[model samples]
Structures are given as C-alpha cells and as structure tokens.
Target: MTRTESLANRLQEVLLNGRWIANTNYKHQLEDITWEQAIKKVGSLNTIAALTYHVNYYLAGILNVFRGGELEIRDRYSFDLPPICSKEDWDNLVDEFLTNSEAFVLEVSKLPDHKLDMPFVDEKYGTYLRNLEGVIEHCYYHLGQISFLKKLIFA
Candidate 1:
C-alpha cells in the first residue's frame, strides 16, 4: 500500500475499529458510555465528555487544514467543551466526532506522498505528516484519559 493509504488505514483502525491492536479503538473505548457517566468529574480531573471534545477539537482543526484552511485552534480554548447534560446531547457529540474523524481520514488518504512532507500551512507548523501523526497520537493520549475517567465514574 502507498504511504498515504497506510496512514489512512492506521487512522481508521485507531478511530473506528482495529484488527491488529484488539480492543483499543476510540469507538470501542467509548462503547456504552452514558451522558451521566461521561460528565462526571473526579477530583478536579476532566470529564470524559470534555476530553472527547478536546480531542475532536484538534481533529476538526486538522480537517480545516485538509480543506484548504489554516490551523486556527488555540490550546486555551480546547477545553471549552459543551454541556453534555442529556443523552441526546452526548450522542450528537459522538456522532459529530465520528463523522468528522471519518472525513479527516478520507481527506488525509487523498494526499499524495509528496504533500505529506510539505509544511502544513506554513513552515512553522511542521509537515502535514507530522501534524497528522500528531493528531493520532493526541487522540490516543486522551483516549487513555477517557478510559481512566470512565473507570472512576462507572466502576
């Protein structure tokens, strides 16, 4: 497979599903989570819902880059998660996250290998591959947080 295709497959495995990695995908990790459980905070820690939004915030920003826009997100505003006060609200958030993730993966898959090495928007931001891989790494890091928070809330 091409490098871009490989990256896309890896992104898909990490987000939607995974075969080689077993039960570590985002969808698998989020399975059966309830709004009440997601919004619970443990000792000043972030809620699962908040972390979910935080991760998606960057993904959405990267999506903009793929769609010919500059990176526009700031870390200070990353944690401004919306209220997940109802199951419908939480469900919609998940739906939006998943849909955007799918689209991001698709857009990245369309990139030629040469574009991967080019700077993402500007030289200061690093290459497209760097940012893309960074997004995946960022998701897994927060996914772990969400997993731990769920244990605290649901266990």
Candidate 2:
C-alpha cells in the first residue's frame, strides 16, 4: 500500500477500531455508554457527549470537503453538542460518528499522496497532510479524555 493508504488505515484504527494506543479505539471506548453517563461532567470537564460531537464535527466537515463540498464548519461550534437526555439522541450521535468516520476513512483512502502536499482549502489553512494528521492526533488526545471520563463516570 502507498503511504497515504497507510495513513488512512491508521486514521481508521484511531477513529473506529484496531489496536492503537491503550489497545482500544474511540468506538469501543464509547460502547455501552448510557445517555446519563455521556452527559455527566466530571468536575469542570466537558461531557463525553460533547467531546464525541466535537471530534465528529471535524470529521464530517472534512468528509464534505472530500465530496467537493465546502468546509463551512467553524471552530466556535465544534463543541456544540445536541442534547443527549434521551436514548435516541445518544444513539443518533453515535450512529453519526460511526457513519462519518467510516466515510472519512474511505474518502481519505482515495486521495493520492501528492494531494497531501497541496493546499487543503487555502494556502493559509495548510496542506491536507497536515490537517488530516492533525485530526488523527486530535482524536487520540480526546480519546484519552473519553476513557478517563468513562472510568470516572461509570465507575
């Protein structure tokens, strides 16, 4: 496989499933999470639900970019999660994450390595490689928080 394909695989491992850091992925960490637990804030920390939305918000926005759509998402609304007071709401959010992450993996796999060095939207935003890798790192950072919050809230 090409280097871009390898990066895509790593991205999938981080977002969905496979042995990465801590031997777990974001999806597995979220498994069996109840709405109450997802929304529970440990001290002043953000809720698991909010963090989940924050990660997927960027993934979905980038997915749109892959499909020739605009990257219209703003950082100001990244943490604006919908209410998770109901089971349906939580389930929907998880579903969206799964779908968006999978689609992101596929779209990323289609890119040629050469595209990674090109400007993503504008030169000011940096290259696709930088942004994509940044997102992967971002997920790992928040995945740690999600794991900690899970233990604190569910324990």
TM-score of each predicted structure versus truth: 0.94, 0.97
- Compare the candidates by TM-score and give the number of the best one: 2
Candidate 1 residue lDDT tens string, 1-155: 88889889988988888746545777877778988888887999988888889888888988887888877999999999977889999999888889988998899899999999998888998998898788878877787787788778777
Clashing residue pairs in candidate 2 (N, C-alpha, C atoms within 3 angstroms): none
Give one clash count per candidate, in the order shown.
0, 0
Over 4 Å off in model 2, which ranges?
none
Lowest lDDT 10-mer window, candidate 1? 19-28
**lDDT of all predictions:** 0.84, 0.91
Residue pair clashes in candidate 1: none
Cα lDDT of model 2 by residue, 1-155, tens digit: 98689888988899888775668888898878998899988999999999999999999999999999998999999998877879899999999999999999999999999999999999999999999889989989999899899889877
lDDT at position 59, candidate 1? 84
Query: Root-mean-square deviation of each candidate, in angstroms?
Result: 1.3, 0.8
- CA lDDT, candidate 2, residue 134: 95
